[model samples]
Target: MKFDKSELQIFANYCVAAAESMAYTLVRTAHSTFVKETEDFSCALASVDGLTFASPRTFGATWYVGLDYGPVIRSLTDYQPGDVCMTNDPYSGFVATHTPDVVMWKPVFYEGEIICFVAGHIHNTDMGGAVPASLSRTLTEIHQEGIRFPPTRIVDKGELNETLLSWMMCNVRAPEQNIGDMKAQIACLTTGERRVLEIVERFGVDAFKAGIGQLLDYSESQSRAVAKTIPDGRYFFAEYVDEDAVGGKPMRIALTLTVDDGLLQFDFSGSDPQLTSSLNVPTGGHPRHALLLVGLNYVLYSLNPEIFLNAGMLRIATCEMPVGSVLNPVEPAAVGMRSLTCVVVQAAVFGAFAQALPDRMPACPASSVCLLNVKTTDTSGRTIMASIGPVGGGAGGSSAGDGSDASGANMAFLRNTPVEINEAEVPIRIQEYGLVADSGGAGQYRGGLAIVMEFKVFAPNTLVTARNRDRTLFGSWGIKGGRAGRTSLFVRNPRTADQDILGNTDLVACQPGDVIRLEGNGGGGYGAPFRRTVEAVERDVRRGYVSRQEARERYGVVYEDGRVNAAATAALRADMAEGPVEANAFFDYGPNRSAHEAVWTRERYVALCQCLETVSVGWRFFLKHQMFDRLAERIAEGEPIDGVQIVFDLFAELKAQFPALAAQQARIKQVA
Candidate 1:
């Protein structure tokens, strides 16, 4: 408020420009294609208190608006001017949710005192692990994924620590690429430092400092105003992930959102326990850990497009996560596939808001990603290690419009790694890459189609590691009479008669000329399929997004020669008879999920999860696996089993064996 309107505008513009410039430097100097092509990086300018006050709007990952710098910043007691701290440890000062993302922070000083900090986060190509890419869906612990770093001063007082840098390189397979990427992070930070200094020297340090505080306050106010508009009440929604990557049994996530007086609280106490798989999210019990509110802030930003986005938005909501739950797993738990978990959190938040603001929300989003790594050999007997893709998943339908196509709505920041780059870098040929036809759920506003991609191996003995894969069983649910999106599929040798469906396999060895393909299911629809116009169905058929038979069956539409047969369509629609919907069926989750829920009702599942707390932490994985395997067997045998009693027996057996854990059961939901 101290400066005039024009002066304030100038300061804001300068900060944004500086952030964008930092991102530009990172992309241009980056060694890994993950940074240059996929653009999996973020940059921001934080005040001395470690609150992000400025970040680029059009560049970098957009989730930092929810990140916390206090945990890392408060621990740096020995910092000096020009010192840079580097970390990738999720439990340490890395602040990143996973190990693949290396975060670097450099202090920006003015008048020999720190005024602000510039930070950059980039995902390295590899960090030496059980698998090549350092991220495996089946990895049981974080230690197996890669070497981790605490907040170490890699650059002290303007001098690079060569010894420390070399030590980090010793743990990774791609030393040159990883170190180069780390240097790129430092370069971005240095660029930001120079830009911030320019602002301070031009506008004076006092004015620059005041401007930073004002900008943060301004962003916070914008968030508060938006929250204030929503009705004050409690909203609850329970959703399920496809499977606990180690097995095929579905996992559940419960959300309770309370909005009162322009403030929000998100609670995840009833969610399933932490898995042995790598899909857990180590949120460290922080409400504003940057990943929890990715969807909420996305909605907020969409509502107020011109509002400023930064850590100040963290002031909008508070979260309470049960300890040992999948979202708040203890240290050393594998958190490589956390983005998949985040997709559920995002959906849950959307569901909560839909209760208050249905017009603003979309149908369920297709949730899953496929990133495959191939290790093969060339003609000269030299081995070539390469990657396939972090394939884009389809997004859900919206009340305002149709959902996004193959590019996920929540992950619009992620771009496909180009096909040309993959072919050039490794011994694989692109057999097919296109949209999956008739996969999207039908609605008045149809859901977008999923992208189907296939590749053929060219080497004799190829080791293929599926770094992250999911959505093999249950699919995205629809809302307000919409249908559920189709689930994801991973197939091996799809072109041959003896094709095999891997069903989200973790790792495998493929021989020469083997083909593998992935079908990322489309987003769910937003309304009744029969309500869709005939013209739209005809166009969909023309574009190969919908088959003619599917158009007639799902939509009750008759089209010929790319034209709507009005008389025939009317008669067909009049006689169309579909299965009866359940009582007040606002959500249509398709048959697979509906069938699963028939046996694993909300009360039964939550009670079972709570009882499992009596089992010791070390034995919980095996016990849960046993329970799910039994349930899967019953489903496979076309028989109904007492899921609640099955869990009770499992818990009672484990508790009786280890009576010491019986008392620990009281600790369940203590954090709630």
Candidate 2:
């Protein structure tokens, strides 16, 4: 069963190829535009114990490379050769994370014995809920998001579960699309079964199992090697979601990353408590939850691109997520918009790693990706649901070079649907789709440019939802004296007489002739702007990526007669170097965040967390909001504020006003 390194490498390639083939099967045969064109799906091969060993490198979403299927597999009492299990309940096994994402797995048997499993998931365009797409930050409960399925057999003993399929079809808005996509997933799993059997026949069942173990071990070793290169220390970082919901207060995600020797521990203790909105992430408090370590995956890949992609790669890291926090919410808490929260999670991890590996890490990326979905009717009045492709933001600038323009950094797997395909399939007209000039932050290496999408709907009473629209208020932070990126903007009838600016609004009712425009956030810059060569700035202006005015103001690059003025540019740079710097010399979080943080400092945040720890989960979010309102009032009244005292005083007043709250607090005290 033992094999040399060269042999292991060859076996690894084979497994990867199998996973890639499975991914292609799903993409080519899927029904919805979200799955086939956008490619918002994943496929992997796992051991019988449910630890993924191989996944596609260049296909599908990379979020599930470290997904653990053990909990769900064990929940089933029995499995047959043709049995395929499916689930979308986040609380059931914490596998799907959201209702729209349906996860499926099939037990692969070779020679009448189980050897491995083939698994994957696809994002359903619509599942029938309060909103058209079944996902919105405004949704307050999981039930509002969509109907959920627990870990159950959709296929048993090679027989289709007609009853279960009917139930699913009845609940969803687009039954045909869902059923077609499900069949494609089944076909993909069948392909995986065939390919896995081929591997087992060539290597023998025993040797195949042994090779899987060795491959996992090799991936773990590679991750540990990368970890060892990072300096040992506790790096703390915090990021904020624009708001828990539309027109709501901000929700913070804090992290304390401790790296000792070659191991890493991420403690998300100071994060905000579970919100009433769907932004909560349901992880079942698992230490190695895939959502918590998505940023770490990107970091490790950046550190060592050759590192193996498997569950073992994530084995080096562990997360400590508070039970009631946004990162690990309890059941019944809506998780429809958990993907948006994970963006902030990724940003927090990247921020922490930037401190530990300052030289290696880039500035913060535009961690916002807006998924645009349209629910409109045809001339026949039949309901139609389709995704109009994702509008992703720019990547952060790095020491190597300027960041990629209008690129999806972490969520790059969700490919953009072509304009021709979208217009043909959906009732919409694509007016403009291109990058915005002067949108990226200025630095020695400028950040990537943001995207601008303008589309007009053709039907009356059409519903559209732009999920995960963020970074409008607080832009991506720039590091090493660089400037923050541009903020996002959403407008209806933009540049017209009736232009309505919709900030962070996910759902909207559109009439015919309504032109909706979405301008996404840009990536943060790296290093100082004045340090950038004038030639580079001029080139950006020439390419229309940066405007001449912005180049002069932000980068101190002067232009005269459509050419760079070397003498004047040097003078401008000299004057710009003496400008007043922000409070944090290392990070430029833009004026909006800087103004917000000026009041809500670290000490106040610590005090807020300490006070929230005393309250029960049900009372935590309410009490925190009340305390924040009181703090703001005190600030406006021109009184010196003490965060701890303010929170305590507010809690005392609230308890006295509400007898039920006082009784609950007494009961909690008695229990403690």
Task: Please report the candidate that would top lDDT against the real structure.
Answer: 2
Cα-based lDDT for every prediction: 0.79, 0.89
**In candidate 2, residue 592 scores what lDDT?**
89
Model 1 Cα lDDT, one tens digit per residue, 629-652: 666676789875565676676567
Instruction: Compute the lDDT of residue 557 as modeled in candidate 1.
Output: 85
Summed backbone clashes in each candidate are: 1, 0
Residue 370 local lDDT, model 2? 94
User: Candidate 1 regions off by >4 Å?
Assistant: 1-9, 380-383, 560-563, 575-579, 629-650, 653-672
Total backbone clashes of model 2? 0
- Global CA lDDT of candidate 2, please? 0.89
Ten-residue segment with the worst summed lDDT in candidate 2?
641-650
Q: Candidate 1 clashing pairs?
A: 66-290
Task: List per-candidate RMSD values in Å.
Answer: 2.9, 1.2
